[model samples]
Target: MFGILVSAFNVVLGFVMRSVIAKFFAYFVMWFITTEFVSVLQSAGILPTASALAGAFGSIGSDVWYFMDLCSFSFGAPLVISAYATRFIIRRIPVIG
Candidate 1:
């Protein structure tokens, strides 16, 4: 029946959406952890990072914030799509009760 198929689709959609969110968050958290670890490693060595010229060699501080921001969006866009699709499906569903 159409209703039964819709029910299965709904369940699968929810599962897939949740899976995507879980994976993205897991990877994002790892990035945060790595950043902290690297920061500590840099500071522990008493190295000054103010000079941009020495950045490539890991002796100076380089701007990694921009790159992180760019990469974060690749994960965020899917979340946005999943959220919108969930909303649209819920709205389109008819209540039989």
Candidate 2:
């Protein structure tokens, strides 16, 4: 009975560790790729800078500009892109999808 319990515990621990490591690796890869992609976009001038966004919002009105600043397009663009990228990647992975 003690041997059986020890075997079961080892099996469960191994499975948990594998799951945690795989998830951590996946998250790290996704983050690295997303940041690189976002940086490339920014360098290419496809994505505007925070100051540029603020400047554009300046003419709109204080209320609207304040709202824009609060929402923060510069920050949001990467977040939105990363979400789609993650979804696309997950769907492409046959085992995970």
Candidate 3:
């Protein structure tokens, strides 16, 4: 699912970004990009199979807004949290001289 994909993306992004910039900025930028990407896909109706599945769940209403919100939050929350947490831990360990 998208949630799993987002989590994996975050893990990779965190690893890559840490070497390029400060932790906070890296985390913020990556999180912003990922969230924006998801939002854009939702708004633009570009999500894979979304249109096809729309009719199947018609009784629930159009577009499944709640489901999208849930997916985004479920996927994005852990990534955002881990981004900062991992950085914090790395920074905390005393370097062996």
Candidate 4:
């Protein structure tokens, strides 16, 4: 009964997770595409706005900060996700008798 319960739980968890991931990625990709489109539009514009002017004000420190933030998130997010997924996969697989 315990084995059955554990197996059932893994199956249910995997199925629900897959469904949620599918939906989440669908919306996520759509959002990324739209944001990229908007960025392209902004770049194509001839005149700059307040945001553009303000963005130009910073010196080396802000540039370093920007790079650091980008690097931290770019590397951190995927590494954390992969590690967490590895743990999840390990947990989900049952040991052979």
Candidate 3 residue-wise lDDT, 1-97, digit = tens: 9999999999989887776567667568666666665566567975536456456546664367587676895578558766874565445434311
How many clashes does the backbone of model 1 have? 1
Position 80, candidate 3: lDDT: 77
* Per-residue lDDT of candidate 1, residues 1-97 (tens digit): 9999999999999998899888888778766665565466567964335464246435423366457466895577558866874465445434210
- Residues 11-80 of candidate 4 have per-residue lDDT tens digits of 9999888998888887787666655654664688843566764576454386676876878855785588
| Model 2 root-mean-square deviation | 6.1
- TM-score of the candidate numbered 4? 0.41
Q: List the residue pairs that clash in candidate 3.
A: none
Better of 1 and 3 by lDDT: 3
lDDT of 4 at 91: 57
For lDDT, candidate 1 versus 4, the one ahead is 4
Worst 10 residues of 1 by lDDT: 88-97
Q: What does candidate 2 score on TM?
A: 0.49
Flag clash pairs in model 2.
none
Local distance difference test scores for all models: 0.62, 0.75, 0.63, 0.65
Best-matching candidate per lDDT? 2
Q: List residue ranges in candidate 3 displaced over 4 A.
A: 1-21, 48-54, 57-97
Candidate number with the higher TM-score (1 or 3): 1
